[model samples]
Target chain A: MEYRGAPQATLVDLLDRVLERGLVLDADIVICLAGVPLIGLRLRAALAGMETMTKYGLMQDWDREVRAGAQSLQKGAALLAGQAVQPGLH
Target chain B: MMEDRSQGQVQEQARPEGAGGEAGLYVYCIGPALGGGCCGVTGIEGREVDAVVHRGLSALVHPCPVQPYQTANLEVTASWVQAHHRVVEAAWKQWGTVLPLSFNTIIRPEGGLSAADALRMWLEHEEGALQAKLDALRGKAEYSFQVFWDPVVIGRQVAEASPDVKRLEEEVQSKPRGLAYMYRQRLEKLLREGMEARAAQECRELYGRVARCAERVHVSRPKEGQEGQVMLLNLSCLVSTGMVAALEAEADGLSGREGFSVRFVGPFPPYSFC
Candidate 1:
């Protein structure tokens, strides 16, 4: 196959996996900067789908809140329709 | 515990200054022994970089302040992440195969051990597992494939094919405005479900096609927030370095099909595999 020479990885993909996946060791010492350990902030909220974030155990709380909100919205719509709640969405 | 710390702050304070001027180690990757030619790659924040060898393994590292790289701002974080990957890429280019470490992996001296001693101790402890991973991944690389379809086009196709949806459309045209609204809602929901079912089938077919060239596959969830584009698959595959070309060719073939947008990337260190 004549390879079209496409660029293999981009910064988004690299950043997504670099800290989230890969071989990590537990024997790490903490570095304190201004009385706080200088461990980096992982901005996972800015990347990944809800499914991916949940798979990696990053955003379960947010996921729960979203689900709950959706459920309530559905219930409110059903009430507005003047109908008893159906067993499930059709 | 290591997995839990992935997103949390690494708050390890060094026991009161026992060794002055000692810097923490920022690790990039570990690999089998290699001949002495410096990679000359810079670490995050332009630190000097080199390797620390013990037994038969070499750890590519650079000395930095004991603190881990952290920034609330994303732009700076991106640069840090980019710099981290650059080192790994350089190591892979020079060393052939490396066991890549995740970003922000910093090891400081703990339990009365200096930073170098701590690293050496960990290397000794994990030597067997590390070596096995390294050997297994020697000639393999990770590739990413993403498949997307235009939702509008899919909805149109679903509308054309589903007789129920077509009947509803006619009912809406005939009914008064109030009742017609409910029919429209039903039709919209039906079309959405139809599109999802079609997408699921397409995803299975694409995965089967791509899996032919893969040694191992890791399926990731599609990122949210595409207004009209429906993602079908987001996956990473570990393939023999030799098969990367074939995978890209397959991706090209998939992209050529109507309404499908395929993105293929990599030859990267097998981050998912590791």
Candidate 2:
């Protein structure tokens, strides 16, 4: 219900207006890019990339770190077992 | 149409002669020619933004290379978009009314005509229409209104409201395990249909209420909602500045309803209206 202004919180709404809705000029004078579809695709990709980074990128990195830690723990356990066996052989 | 008095003025003022590149005038928005320049606002890439005037209208512009401002970098693109919006917002505040151009709207110089001249001539030709639009949008701003509903809640309500769905729910409960599974799927489908119908009715009622508070309403495609919510209505409303409170009051009422949430943002420079 709060009437939000154009801040970072409303970037999606701002982009919708700035990218899609506005006064269009005659084709002859304006430097027309391919069209809205192309621009929309590019912006959507960029935004999707950003969302992925914010939402899952950190979690993926954390998952890797946790797996590495577990691997190191396993290696330590193997090393301790090897030491225990070496003493028995000696 | 006015004669082109300043043949090289746009080129000279927008960019340095023999700058050895094809540069174009990137227009942000257009407003009534108020004589005084654009309060020294800077636009994309920190380029100084000024106005190209023609018969009581001005197009706020900055000089840039002929290429569109685009990039693979999300941050860069976002910055450009934000800068474009900032300039337009500034113009809107200063000029009292403006017709905002989409992002990266660059006016390139045509054959034998400088970009600035092309802009000026276009403005002259479109003066009547542009002025009419600006007049119509003078005291209004565009607002974004989106309604998201909790699908789980709406689905439950639909199930309780529809007799068919209630009967199926009871049948599913009474049937054998395997048959009950099949009945559950059928029940879900029926509930989904009821939900869609209910959603349509809610949308119509909400649109009617919100439309009354605004001068103009543009229905936009609803987007996917976050978490468990589903977007029901997305609208861009052109509301007179004085009527913003009334619009907010309506939004507040909608948001207060159980299972429904509203996103009402703006006072934007009538971008959709344009």
| Tens digits of per-residue lDDT for model 1, B1-274 | 3443343323322223335444688788888878564477787768677788889888888876565666443445656777778888788778778888877677887888877778888889989988998889888988888776665666678889999999999889999989999998898888867766676667767787888889988887654213334446778899997887788788888777666677687778888888
A1-90 per-residue lDDT for model 1 (tens digits): 111443545556776677666666655453432222232344654333345446656445445545553553353222111111111111
Put down candidate 2 lDDT per residue, A1-90, tens digits, no spaces.
Answer: 323331223556777888888887756787765345245567665543443433433333323433443453353222112122122111
Runs of candidate 2 exceeding 4 Å displacement = A1-9, A33-38, A51-90, B1-22
- TM-score of every model? 0.76, 0.81
Q: Candidate 2's residue-wise lDDT over B1-274, tens digit each?
A: 0122133223323433355265689899999999777856788868788789998999999877675665544445556778889899999998889999888788888888889998888898999999999999998988888887776776778778889988888888789999999998888678656766677678778888888999999887666554445567788999998999998888888878878888888778898988
* Model 2 complex DockQ against the native: 0.15
DockQ of each: 0.18, 0.15
DockQ of 1: 0.18
Winner by lDDT:
2
* Candidate 1 docking class: incorrect
What's the TM for chain B in candidate 2?
0.91
